[model samples]
Target: MNSKSHVPFIRTVKISERSGKDTIKIRIAAFVLALTAGGLFILFLGYNPLELYGTIISGAFRSKMAFQATIRFMIPLLMSSLGVALAFKMRFWNIGAEGQIIVGAVCASYFALFHDNWPHFLLLIVMFAAGAIGGGLWGLIPAYFKSKYDTNETLFTLMLNYIALHIITYLRDGPWKDPGSSGFPKIARFTSNAQLDKVLGVHFGWIIALILLVLVFIYLKYTKHGYEISVVGESKSTAKYAGMNVKKIILRTMVISGGICGITGMIQAAGSDMTLASSVAGGVGFTAIIVSWLAYLNPFGILLVSFLFSVLEKGSSVMQSTYGLSTYFASVLQGIILFFILGCEFFIRYKFVLTKKGGK
Candidate 1:
């Protein structure tokens, strides 16, 4: 449908460390540029940009519930984004994480559906294993094809998204439909013991997510495999030439990426939603791409940017009704923001000058 939310096909570029300053400047410039674009759009639509933004600010920050909602939204997005960031760092495109999350959630749901009476400890094990295995399998499909037949992973993974959506829809409507409900769409409520704990009105998934950030950070920084990932991502041919097992690393890193995404799905099922539905994943796989990009492939940066996205998303509803701003306005804002960020990269990498090198 090419909605305004559609992410453009941005070729991955591994920026050097030297560009860190440029990255900061880009963030500043992108904010300014996005604001300008948003203002112009609001004027064209016969609305005040100031009013729209002010409403969003109050809506997003005025209440504790809004803050909790923001954390809830950020946690899964951060999880999925971390997965994507790892894959992107390795030069592997995991566009099917959306599908992988569904695979994980669907599998976790089944575990609880049947093992509802198992002890909490054993049930947790069963759920996590199912979720990890499910997402890993989903990831393997694309990796297998890419590794064996040199297939285009981008297309392969994109198609998997729809396949997964249909699978969840079928399960909820047919086999797993709650017996007492007439037309509602959802599975039986999941077992309570299988879910993550709520911390101060929020899920412990956020806490786990933060711990993962540190672990993944250390994993990539100090481990030999992380070194190989960077090397292979830099050049597969070069990696192979240097005695690194290119194929093994590809499969293994992807498994890691997929496994984490599966955990994200499990959290959504166990901690947040407590059941399987067509909307279980909430398009998180796609949004994670934005998070990864904004984080500049830095896990710590992903953590902060994720929370920022949460605010905008949760605030959109307020903007919609409080100021009569359409939902489309949110999409416009994201687009403009992304545009400026992408454009800023150009300024960082190259400088414009006249052919004479002096005259304008």
Candidate 2:
């Protein structure tokens, strides 16, 4: 009936069968805990924690490249998180987003590579469509298993991730292997027109990401399908009793989720990398799951939180350069934040009472 995270800060929130009452103070306390943990880590390294924090903020916004990097990172994160959020609205855990992303990249890349000279605009359209279809199909696969045989969707989706990885590996060393290239282990270089163009020095992927965010917001807030998803997520029995096709919504939402994830793959492929391989997903799909969870599946909140992660990643590069810190240090920082946020979610749902002085 309820889920819990094995985080230490368990008293931060109290969640229930539905929405639970909450106060802002709990959030502030959790932040304080996160900041304390992060600050202590810096102090343990014998570095000025204040300088580290300051450097991060400065790097994120003080330079053009830094700003662009933040935007670049934010776009995929926003797109993936929104997709995750949409499915989450239906309580459908489609964890194969990473696979869907890879499938999309592979589809678009293969199409662009083999297809004869078509219009530049047409090529772009094909790539986008291919990416969406690949991801959608990957997503639908799990839905099929779940609806047709009552398979555990979480496990079904999770397993698909490895399938994507295996396919990427096979291609990197086999069919898609470029004869001219050597041990770097990647795909062949794509054509110039295969890449997405920049608008005002920022990749146009950001524009698409923003447009999708708004579209998702509108769909979830105003549409009947969205209403169905919410109902089905809350209860299959209730949804069925209400004459809503619960299984259909689950399958439909997942397809949409996967399609968006595929678009994200396209951004990394054509918009940024201009090629595809195992690195196509860039772990954004996994991270976006948390972003969606933390944002409570609100598209607008995902925008803000995704921006936060983007800044952290951008500033992390500065941390590496200015303080001679490892880029892994940023991962440490993010891990800490995620720990706290996830802990808070659990606490929002459950509680522990210390009845004895012994603190059982």
Best by TM-score: 1
CA displacement after TM-score superposition, residue 182 of candidate 1 (Å): 0.6
Model 2 stretches astray by more than 4 angstroms: 1-22, 345-360
lDDT of 2: 0.84
Tens digits of per-residue lDDT, candidate 2, 70-135, equal: 898898889999988888888888888888888888888887777727777789899999999988
Provide the lowest-lDDT 10-residue window in model 1: 351-360
Task: Please report how far candidate 2 places residue 53 from its true position, in Å.
Answer: 1.5
**Alpha-carbon lDDT, every model:** 0.82, 0.84
Error of 2 at 21 (Å): 10
Give the per-residue lDDT digits (tens) of candidate 1, residues 17-84.
54567668767978787888888888888888787777777778889998888788888899889888
lDDT of 2 at 127: 93
Number of residue pairs clashing in candidate 1, backbone atoms closer than 3 angstroms, sequence gap of 3 or more or interchain: 0
Clashes of each: 0, 6
Supply candidate 2's per-residue lDDT for 11. 33
